[model samples]
Target: MPIPMNAEPNDGCEGAVKGAGENIVAVSPAALSPDDEVALRRAIGELRRESLAMRLTALIGRQIGFIGLMVPEPIAETINKTAESALRSAMGIALASLGDRSTRDRRGLHKSVATMAGAAGGAFGLAGLPIELPFTTTVMLRSIADIAKSEGEDLSDPDVALACLEVFALGSSGAANPIERGGALEAGYFALRSLLAKSVSQAARHLLDRGLSNQASPLLVRFIAQVSARFGVVVSQKLAAQSVPLIGAASGAAINYAFVDHFQTLARGHFTMRRLERIYGIVMVRAEFERLARQI
Candidate 1:
């Protein structure tokens, strides 16, 4: 005899009896229960709005900062126009990737822009506001890259503007290899040498232009040799992963701080004392690099 659906087994067992023939369990096609389905939809909607707002905010901040730093009005305007176009292209790409067919809220984007502009105006209005040209330029470049990423665009292609950034952050040896031993130490030395070379080269050019050609030759030769040595260090670390944050943060902070010479001196000492500590310091400085990257 067949066991009933609700019957317990009588063979000294307290559990329900198994069916003799094949038994089938039916499952609904929907993975979520009705309440869960509604909750999920609400959550997704909120996330989409939040993401859009954050991107908009970053775009506005970057654009305003770039424009505010330019000294010449015409040049600034030209650069601003070009930057705006680039931003639009990036945003379009992002929207398409997200499957968002709706047009973006221009008013909202403009509002963000206006707010940033106002803040910039107030900050620059103060007397003796030091110019942060390099930091602003870096921010603009990062913004452009972020836009591209959000649009699902591949900035890793050699033809892309973001290739330099990718190489700086992820390393130039491609994804398959690990950093070579002693590469980090070499990178620190090369970076310092590169700075020294730039300083020397600039000084030489200035002296030569002032009709001190005789004085400039010796300095130029020394700078050339320094640059060559720097190149050797760079080559040694060529296979290593570039810590984007470290370089970016250090450079950015150097731009903002007034006593950059003092800071650089301290940095050199740190590099000499401990290689990992130097790298960590650089990473800490460029903490914004990752956050800015994710915005795009």
Candidate 2:
């Protein structure tokens, strides 16, 4: 059953794909259960509505309180270095305790984000980067782990756990298309999904068997470094937002709040599309998704 190009998008409907004269769905011949189909459709709907430019605009946009403040070069470098170190530490801890994290509610995670942000923002550099950096990084790592759980990916397995690491790397991907209008945003989303989707499992296996750094495949370690760089970009922007004279802890906390919140949304959307891809075939979903993207 070839779906006509003119057919209206029902959003909630699980349409079929033509195959061998049999009415086969894209990923299976049998129809998906109502609940599963609904989940799939909802995920697809989100992908269609997600705007690359809008997300980028929000990421790079100045914080309301410190719009015109300029970040000094040394201060910027400190921000990036601290963030990179934090992320490196975070990855080590996550790997070591991969299977040991106890069940946690999102409420706990939310509180953690606020607490770290509050502490980091309260006196920030006044208290030394050592104190502030760990607090913020640990909080972020835990939040990212929670996001992995929500996505139905198990963190116990090295393969699955590495995927969570990739999410942080993908966080600051808004630079590609800063324009609010045009198809660039949609194209950017697809490009991002493509980059992160392949080689995750393979890379994870290599990392686990090789143990931490030095002996680990140079290529795999490099990939992890690249991900850290993405996070570094975010940290740089955040320091800029919080660096203004008299900006205070409240403003810094606000910036931290936005940072974690943005990544959580990213995980949800990415996993949703992944589920849909498993069910409907990536080619089909991408084609239809791109079509919807063009319309939007």
Candidate 3:
């Protein structure tokens, strides 16, 4: 089916993606050029690759088991703490001085850095995560920022940086369809965005107005907490996979490549959606996004 030109959710366009309990924003569809429609279709494909959990499973060829059995259960707690701290530190120092915002994204360089970090972590098995995870996360944040700029995001804008952090949260889920098997919209892309919208806005506002002097302010803290919760899920999975017998530096490097590649895919899709939203308004673009998602 060809993509819809007019996706009016409230006006009863077919397959309009309404959040389970959220209010739909009322906005008219803009006249999207043919190029814009094609771009929207491609973005939907990338978003559908939301299943990082499955991707890791496929790449490693091993089923990740329960936390306690794979490694010490305390590692789970450590993973969450590490995720939060890494996000905090990355926000403070990662891309602020990237320099030359107009240049093309250096995707290969970022992947190489992540692979090296992963090898270092993999060498010590689970023992290395506390040290390696944060460093690798910071590198992934830089890559995400690079993709955001490639998609035309202004890196100086606090909201865009917050969106960069959002990739971790979004990449943790594995849902392909917005409407799940039992019709729950609990973990879909649009649903997740709806959930995070308030904290994201508040955090962005606080950063824009007061700067990052006090990173522990209520709004920013809440945003980091929320993102860290989801990010911990993926980290846990990666840890479990790493717990597999004989996972040396080589396997670790491969897994890390897949890890960074997964987020890069999500980042590309997300920022592409944002770019289209800037042009056609989110409501129309989102409605059309769901329409295409259903068709696939």
Candidate 4:
């Protein structure tokens, strides 16, 4: 389904808004001249390339960060391999779904794409150092959910997906506008509630174990709580300030984090791989959202 042009922002941010308006005015998807399309395609290609490089860098950074703590090489290796493999598989499935010949065969494929697109959008916004990675990841997921719904998918049953996306949109938007921060916070709190509601009890237990177990060091829990809290604040403020539709950029950021965090946590044994994979299906929906976001 075509992404709604109205969802895009128009406050002179970049060519995305301007181009989107122009395209809307022209009333032709083919209104993009060959030259324009070529340029857009090239830019998108570059963005995709850069996103891949960034993803690799983030992966390596995570590996190195864990290793710096003197983690066992075998455990680190296993974590890195699993995270990389999962990310690659998810991306592959998402891209393929875009071109699936059979519309009927596209349900699962489409969802996967939407999820990843949200992730990619978030990744695009948070590529710099001192990584605000989690915020961007959430935005991506939220964007995916929004996009999927536009395409006629009902995502209400999947609380994890909803929570991740809600937090992302809220956080990213809050970052952009402080007054809106409260909304982002509310959305984030709700998302957390949703995640807990849908989350398997065992998976929650594992997260607590890896994060807050007696055997686990206090430093780890402290770090997780700190980061999570910061994210929560940013997202909540964003949601409070504006409607969800106004926070597309933030939504993209949130989705990106959701996928990355999900995989990383799974690899680190902070969550059950099987349960996480079930949640990972949201990635597909995110990818499609990203594609549509770009078009918009």
Candidate 5:
């Protein structure tokens, strides 16, 4: 999708994204040109579509776990271990990737994610849960960091990097919870919205200036992981999908693709929302988001 270069504050919204927008006291719809209106429509449309997709994947991920349970007890336990290990590895690599942006080939990175996902499936088939998990997790987190960068954040700043990590929580929206009718992902986005850096600026600031690695206190790392677990139900679902024998290398590859792409969309819209909040004020953007979310 073509990203809007100059558009701000009016990107993704819950309700109709036409005719410029409603007039705010500080900014008027009269200022919007025809092109701006079109861009807003496209931007909001993409966010809505991606949000819906994330919900669908979450629902599907939950159901897939039972199928894996059909496997033998011994094998199931092993797969679970693999899944946890994969997540740990992915978490480390993804964080490391954020520290460097000098050598980036997003296209190449996409290929690498696919390749790793495919290889894991082929080598272990349904048994390669450990390998598959890390591939998708790492790739999605990297995509999150990339989205942060596009939203004008410096990944070098620990606060920005922490925000990217929190995108994983967005996945928790429909995990095992009763999705609010049509508002699964939408509701999830709102729930975690407060957890984002803008909403949690004070906490993020402390982590930003402190040494990330050399000075990263155990207290801080533990704090981040604890906050992260608040939305960790979805991670369980993703791991559950590993048990499906029906999805081999090709299946694994497809799942990884969807996983990364879904987060990329989330990160894009999320960062876009933050950018909008900066221009139009947090209260207005959030109110509009909540309103539009109901429609979704």
Candidate 6:
């Protein structure tokens, strides 16, 4: 069942979560029921996988050497620049077109569209990247919006639209080892949100205040740039994978399938976290997320 977006907090639990056999720990009042805890645990497990980089590495690295080595300096630059531009357009135009339409999401439809685009791009190889990436990125954004809506987000809210955009950044962050960067809180899902929180808020404010006419405004650019920085890493990996010798349209389609699928997985986890955050406050959800990550 779809989780309710605006669930009311139940009375019983207050200020602390019950642990093993009556052991209690201080936490936010947004305590989960037994069932909700199970769902939260499953979502946290998915979030912790860090699968995109590893999946790409395994799939592509086996055929070619390390995925990173396949790309030349020029192509890498092109990938990064293309990613930035495509994301900017997605935020301005792609997501702007999305609205809360039906109860069920059209994930399959969006993925098929992206796959075909990838096939077309793959036929031309790297030369087709500039055109291919933007279209596919826009499709991905649409799929993400569908996921967000399924998770009970109000797409009419500029903040939620930006949150859909944030999924791109989240996918890249998951590929990295959050623990390696110092502290758990310093790097994982929460940290990434914290980092983008300012830009997202500012950009959302700009959209609300001025609309899409000033998409080039400094506030929006900063937000897009921040998202693009992390997003570019995955895009580079994708380019390197597609660069392997004789990777024709069919292979390109396969890679593109994975590409959209990766973000879709992250979107589900991300929006699920957001859904839980709405139910239980962020503090409680985050604390539980950390605890569950350790247990898992």
List all candidate RMSDs to the true structure. 27.4, 8.2, 6.1, 21.2, 8.4, 7.0
Candidate 4 per-residue lDDT over residues 1-296, each given as its tens digit:
12221122222121121221233221222133455334334432322232221232253333222222353555334433332332223222332233212233232343355445544433433222112323333333333443343334333322222222223222222212212122232332223333433222223233334422331334333323333443333322222222223345554444344333332221121112112212222232223223433553
Better of 2 and 4 by lDDT: 2
The weakest ten consecutive residues by lDDT in model 5 span 14-23
lDDT of each: 0.28, 0.53, 0.73, 0.30, 0.50, 0.72
So what's the TM-score on candidate 3?
0.84
TM-score of each: 0.17, 0.68, 0.84, 0.21, 0.63, 0.83
Query: By lDDT, highest first, what's the ranking?
Result: 3, 6, 2, 5, 4, 1
User: Which should have the higher TM-score, number 1 or number 3?
Assistant: 3
Candidate 2: residue 70 lDDT (0-100): 53
**Tens digits of lDDT, candidate 6, 1-105:** 122222222332333322112323332343688887887877776566655657665665543325665678887788789989999888777766765556467
lDDT over C-alpha atoms for residue 90 of model 5: 57
lDDT of candidate 3 over 1-296, digit per residue (tens):
11111223444222342322233453434566788888878887787764655666676777653432365658778888888987888888785665436756788898999888887786776678778888888889999988888877777777777888998898766554443434434667877888888787678668768878889899999999999988877777777777777766677777788878878888898888888765556566766776666666
- Per-residue lDDT of 245 in model 4: 35
Per-residue lDDT tens digits for candidate 5, residues 9-118, read 43323122211123232342323245533333444544555332344346445455444335566655554455445445655677755674753437348646655664
Candidate 3, residue 109: lDDT: 94
For model 4 the local lDDT of residue 220 reads: 30
Off by over 4 Å in 4: 1-22, 25-77, 97-100, 105-183, 186-296
lDDT of 2 at 116: 68
**TM-score between candidate 2 and the true structure:** 0.68
